[model samples]
Target: MGKHIKTIARPALQSTIKGCGCGECQTSCQSACKTSITVSNQVCLKESKQHR
Candidate 1:
């Protein structure tokens, strides 16, 4: 007969969600660019998670 195996618990994972710093920009165009960049990055991360 085979010996029984035990499972071990893993530590909780931590992550930081950072923005593209659109709010810190002086011009409206710059702010809009930041916002778009941030949103695109976020969406990419989400998709990557699903694939993994």
Candidate 2:
């Protein structure tokens, strides 16, 4: 027997990148970038503010 693997759909990948969410949400142009690639949550272009 084989283990089942969960997966996200391709049509979902067809969606766009919204924001980096690093607290630099000043402008639409600043917060967004056109991407033909997928971004990993493990990496951030900017540091986020404290959650307090």
Candidate 3:
């Protein structure tokens, strides 16, 4: 008998964002990635530090 393996979806940044857009999602510096999964420290820090 063959065993079946269930497939799991990759955790995307959108899922980690908690809320969609709504301003709240953008608050976290870690969630700054356009795609959101890969957190861009340079951009997030630069944006928040320089812009804010």
Candidate 4:
């Protein structure tokens, strides 16, 4: 019989900042910005499957 594997999504160690033009919060900081900035540190997940 063949075993069935389950897939799962999980955050990886490597991540990047989103909406930050300079990659670093210099003049326009999302947290301190008056206007709504969808700036956030995004973590990418790998497509992996697990065996149960």
Candidate No. with top lDDT: 3
For residues 1-52, write the lDDT of model 3, one tens digit per residue.
Answer: 2268555655555653653334422443444455454434324443355577
lDDT of 4 by residue, 1-52 (tens): 2268555756643553443234333233466446534443432122121221
Candidate 3 — worst ten consecutive residues by lDDT sum?
19-28
Q: Ranking under lDDT, best-scoring first?
A: 3, 1, 2, 4
TM-scores of all predicted structures: 0.19, 0.16, 0.19, 0.17
TM-score of predicted model 4? 0.17
Better of 1 and 4 by lDDT: 1
Candidate 3 positional error at 41, Å: 13
lDDT of each: 0.42, 0.40, 0.45, 0.38
Please give, for residues 1-52, the per-residue lDDT of candidate 2 as tens digits. 2268555543543333564445553332323454323334333335334332
Please write out the lDDT profile of model 1 over residues 1-43, one tens digit for every residue.
2368554645432332454343433332335545543433333
TM-score of model number 3: 0.19
User: CA shift at 11, candidate 2, in angstroms?
Assistant: 17
Question: In candidate 4, how many Å is residue 52 off?
Answer: 36
Better of 3 and 4 by TM-score: 3
